[model samples]
Target: MTNTNNSLNSASSKASPKCWPILPAAGVGSRMQADRPKQYLPLHDQFLMDHTLRLMLSYPKFEQLVLVLSETDPYWPDSAFANDPRIIRAPGGSERCYSVLNGLRALEGMAAEDDWVAVHDVARPCLHHSDLDALFSAVENSAINNTGACGAILASPTRDTMKRGIKQPDGTITIDHTVERDQLWHALTPQVFRYAELKQALEFCLQNHLEVTDEASAMEQVNKQPLLVAGRSDNIKVTRPEDLALAELFLAQSLNQS
Candidate 1:
């Protein structure tokens, strides 16, 4: 997991051979309104996809990186990830869950049955090393016998009063009520889990005809309330036009810190 620019060492010489990172980058960024996907958007010197790749490639222990992507993307044949010896590409699916399934399918041929996969979105570029540390700590105990577990996105708690509203056809909104400010947590990605556990959850969803929002929701369908490792607010998702600027600022700050 190293090149001339990156220095990496195994956490243990024996090497725990299971856990890896899987990135779902097949989404065409409709919100960005660009012909290209949001992941192809430029952030500083590297493309947004590169930012995501850098995060995992920067880590030393992950043996392989499975990128779930569209075959049609121009970024294909690109060296950002293809240059790495440990990087693998898997064709994406119709939905995020399905894309993950395709990734798991690729892993199924080679990885251990109980291997772990940390699923992350391509748009989230502000993930920190501390957040990664916290997530591993939460499930470190479960790694003992390979009965690995589920863990969710980290996000800062809400400090502002959340408002509920009704949108009218006239382009006006009415505040229905002020939602409770005390109980809210925003979800961000790099959501980690056992590959088999997630595969089970997705299979359950497919059988039950459920369309869940996040990976955690699919797991919840299977009676799993994943542990959340609170990540910083700076870890943001670029889902709308306005978020690009916010993301730019976060990226600037992130580089300065590093």
Candidate 2:
């Protein structure tokens, strides 16, 4: 078994910025067509959210976890982590950005301005420990390099040939043009940002009515470019029903390797 405490202590000694984890679990999984929220669905005989929570909790560097849940979420109480003292509840908002902001707000008295907040998706249950380590390393390196980067996010360079599509009056879609995939990347979770910087960027976006897809985008709107740290492809977010099987497979494979 991994020595969680030792790992955390090692990371703390090397990493200059303290890190905290924020999980947004307010979505209803509309595309999943499931009876319950996708996070509440079963994965390896446990709630999907349970697996995600355990993964974050295992990281000893994190002082606490801020979980954003919908106000009326009945399944949250049933979660195995609901009673964990390390986990704090935050009221969910209408949009992902709002939910993230709420989670950040909950950290008011606890986290310092320069502390790093790693915002991860609750549905992504297969985040590898190596990826987490890499993310923290990248952020620390940026500070050492004086890159002026506000934060960092886990991302994967696009592998598939890209295309832009256009729909005709006949309802047939055709490629409008080929998109250059060289610089494109699929943004993943555990996006880490300095607490104060992230909060300011998010608030700026909200005030201007800008669409904040991810924390990186919000930072971008404020003229802050966040570093993209490459992560493993296995770190997939469970959206549709079909993704559950793949997540289970990845989790099992990861366990075998460990």
Candidate 3:
């Protein structure tokens, strides 16, 4: 894949009912204990966001990439793709849902309501191409036939026993009960949805003051059951400091395979 970035103006004529990627990178990852946002942290020799942008740009399916960053973000200007035209910037919101909404609004005239939008986490730098293919296939088959909801998320089934915990006033924690793990899945990113459907779902959640932990939850409030496409477990979100090393390993493995 070429490293060159195309401008949104140049790709407008080619835009149609195709998938677009919305990347939200506005969070201050306190857990990372880093001087800058985790997305701006260096991995190998480049910023983490660069790895992610390159991966998404490598995919020919996406028409353009919408990147939402905080208004006060200082690290973005230093990014390798800071001047890349293919990437359109959207002002980040206070919350993740709001940021995603802003990105959708940025594509107002460019993307049709029925077009697919894939919302991915900027911290997830190791998203494999095969997993992306699976998500696209699942969304296309289900959305086109109306056999399933147009929204779908890449997830992995829980592998370990789950539990509910109760924090005592003394700062001690106790298990409330052992929970059944069957039918439970860990939701991952690059959640795909119809442009209009996702926008409406998020608006509905905001109106109702409901908590939307992910895109799937917003759709659920509207009684939409999004399909879950199983993805590789290594598609990890870099939250803590240790996760960065693991992501590097995964990226290396992917490169060897390619």
> Which candidate ranks first by lDDT, i.e. highest?
2
Ten consecutive residues with minimal summed lDDT in candidate 1? 5-14
Candidate 2 backbone overlaps, count: 0
Candidate 2 Cα errors over 4 Å, as ranges: 1-16
Decide which is better by TM-score, 1 or 3.
3
Instruction: Write candidate 2's Cα lDDT for 86-168 as tens digits.
Output: 99899999999999999999999888888899999999999988899999888888888988988899999999999999999
In order, candidate lDDTs are 0.78, 0.93, 0.91
- TM-scores, all candidates, are 0.85, 0.92, 0.92
Which residue pairs come into collision in candidate 2?
Answer: none
> In candidate 1, what are the lDDT values of residues 1-258, reduced to their tens digit?
356324334445224546778888899989899767888877786787788788877876576789998988777565376667787888988889888878888887677655667888878877777788787767665566445455555657888889999998998999989999785878777777777888888888988899867778788898887776778888888878777779889888888988
Positional deviation of residue 217's Cα in model 2 after best superposition, in angstroms: 0.3
Backbone clashes (count) for model 3: 1
Pick the winner on lDDT between candidates 1 and 3.
3
Give the alpha carbon lDDT tens digit for every residue of 9-106 in model 3. Answer: 45654444678899998999899999989999999899999999999988989757999999999988899999999998999999999999999999
lDDT of 3 at 131: 93
